[model samples]
Target: MPRELVDYRDSEEALRASEARLHEAQAVGRMGDWELDRDTGSMSWSPQLFRLFERSSALGTPDLNEALGYYSLESVELTRAAFWAAIDTGNRRELEQTVLLPSGAERYHATTIVPVKDGSGRVCKLYGTTQDITERKLAEQELRRKTYEIEDLYQNAPCGYYSLDANGLIIRINDTQLRWQGYEREEVVGRMHAAELFSPASRALFGQVFRTFKRMGVLHNMDMELLRKDGSILNVLMSSTAIFDAQGNFVASRTVLSDNTDRKQLELERTAHATRLADLSRHMVDVQENERRKFASALHDHTSPNLAALQLTLTNLARALPPAALPGLQPLLDDAQALLLDTTSGIRDICTNLRPATLDYAGLIPAVQDYAQQFRLRTGIEVHLDTADFTMQLPSNVQSLLFRIAQEALTNCAKHARARNIRIHLSNRDTRLVMRIADDGVGFDPHHLGEAGTTSPGIGLITMRERAEFAGGRFSLRSHPQSGTEIKVTFDVGRSGVLRPARRASDFANGTTLPTGTQ
Candidate 1:
């Protein structure tokens, strides 16, 4: 034979081998082949097909009825109808049905049937394959059940769940979060970034928090405010963790959000209540001081002058008496004068205590000077008042508050410190008024004085602090056992001064000029 003829023969043999291998491959894949002879009305099944029907090849070719009987009753009817329909219409059909094997085990098989027509256009045969698809069907059913479970959890979970991409874009959200925002899931998911759900100020804070989270891997209990679709803000306690890929690069984040609006509202309400209480306290102190001033004025104007006049009248009457009568009345007159003098002095002292007259007679400096003089005269403890750079004309209320604070400090020092010498310094600098009172006295522990059951109860100090705070000033006291005590108070000059910014020191100090409204 020639070379071409020999090559052609070899190719034909190779083609036959390939076809055989293809058939073997199909059988190995649990696919059974079948064919039908139209003229004989006989069906031929491969060995695997016979096994698929739970029968041996000893039964040989089966009739259509025999093949139908191998399927369940319902499957049998369905398959028979489909087979005949395909044969009559020349249409192909593929379907899955269950069959009972000889071992009584039920098996699922997928069958494909193709119709063949003869030269006369009459259906002659059907050929197709049947595959064992039981495992695939079971796996598909399991997957569908798990998918439903996951969806149910996402829809009904109590906490808000959300996922954001690396750019803070919202990728996924659960029904809980959508409901919180008064929105449907479709309204926001994949349509907005997480930052978009926040107010402008909150967005800036969120950006910083997000960067921190990215660097830290997780951020817990981050308090933030989120804006809803309706433009209302919600306080939320949120926690989130960054999701990373296998390579450890951040990909997205998962966040859990809880509504804390009620808690935030409660906190705001508490702050408001505190402010109201503080205001009430300040108003009470003002009222008390006004009452004291009224009482002090009445005592000075009505009581002290009456007592002095009574003493003078008694002295003139005693001098006019006879010598013998004078001796008898002298003791009485002397006692009357002493009592009158005592009454006048007591009234003056009470008046000063109620509202120091020096405060009105002179400026704060002269008032402090008079107080120091009186204190030293009474206690024999030397007190020095140093007032410089104190030219501002302060509001009367501020002046009263400062005076009361100084009075309280001096009284406390006298009673508790048992000091010999005291120094008070008042100055104005850098738009602020500063006052310091120091004593070379036996000092007690400030902490102990503030505590319960300690020597020298700190009621006076507490009162002083409250007074200073009411005046919009700061107060602090420093003292330790065997150490000298120091009390300092500072107030903003702009707030304390009654005069305008343009007022000069001479206008206030020299009394040459009055404030804008004063005569």
Candidate 2:
């Protein structure tokens, strides 16, 4: 072949290769190029443009007006406007357009138009590129929706949320907490310290714990009182997590607060109700004791004296009549005297049991001793009173309550505990009193008390417990089969009311020694 012919063929081959590369690039990018002839209003499209509109290459590129039909109604107007603007201004324009394909499917495209001007600066042609952006657009829409949802949840959740800086200043706070404290966002965030939100006592507590919290990085369920804008207090349970810097230094904190005002109020009201009930019970016990004293006094002063006088008059009459018929009537007089003496003795015993004068005159120790003596005489149970460590002056109600509990305990031991011995131990410290009545008996289950079809300790035990509790003392019973029964009552002597069970007493119950003064 001639050199010119060979050169021409080589140039044509190079141009064909360049066209092939352009075609491949457009397909990979999901982009197509198009041009509009300004004078003829005809349009030309790349092969990718054909695919973009779902049209076959055989149908050929459509005219300007026909091409506009591929876009929806709104997009058509926008496309026309963009074309004219590019022609008028000779500037490149970019916009996103919605394209309706031949298959009734919608797609998103980013369209850029660059006006091609001739040498005279007259806009003779318009060229543009449309890239398929449907996937990117859908992904962006989903991301925006999720962002809005998360923001909404953060701002409107039921519990209060806030963030604090290392300096303990309020850095970020949510709308829910703003409403709770009756403050606007501007007033709280960045303007106030975290301690300002709490009452004086709670603020002091928070300050003390915050330093430790920074080192630990976590705090859970701390009770706090918040001072609201209106000067009222709100109770909340607060939890916090610390955010740290790269160096492990504390940077900020994320805190959540749960409102427990209603729960706190309920607790206070419950405590008040319990206090009232205890007061009423104590009053009733005092009243019952007073009535017993009056009844015993009346029998002792009037009934006993009258019975003794009647006995003497009957004796004198017997002596006067026995002179005439001494031998026959003497036995009848003796029987009458014996009946009178038994009646007098029974009345005296009843009076002593009702309100023992020793109890009122000599206090609890003597009262317990006297009652124990009588209990031993009646039931043949050996009683031991241990008061070697007790040396406090108790309130009258406490003394009475202890005596009554001891009395009931001994009575129960006599009735149920087929025991040979009882030990009544009394001990006290500065303000605490402990009394334990233990019996060496065949013990029964304490838990089964009052249950049907079970051998119980009986109502006497319940009465003893009530009496102890009514006087502001704690009562406990420990027993098991073959282990013996022990009844314990503890009181706060200073308060003359109930005391919580001491740990030492529990230790002692488990067969360990109590502190120095108690058994």
Task: Give me the candidate number with maximum TM-score.
Answer: 2
Candidate 1 residue-wise lDDT, 1-519, digit = tens:
999999999999999899788768777787788887756667877777776676877877788777777789888977877788888899999888888776887888899989988899878888888988878888888999999988978776777889988888788998877887888777777888888877787889888878878767897887888788899988888898998888887899999888888888987776565555545655676788789989899778887778778877887788778778988788888888888887887787788778788787775677777778888888898888887656677766667778888888899888888899898888887667778888988877664665666556378877776565544556677776788788887777565353112222222232211111111
Window of ten residues with lowest summed lDDT in model 2: 508-517
How well is each residue in 489-510 modelled by candidate 2, as lDDT tens digits? Answer: 8877655444332332222233
As a TM-score, model 2 comes out at: 0.85
* C-alpha lDDT values of all predictions: 0.77, 0.84
Model 2 ranges with Cα > 4 A deviation: 1-25, 54-60, 70-73, 100-106, 294-302, 315-334, 341-357, 447-455, 469-472, 494-519
Give per-model TM-scores: 0.60, 0.85
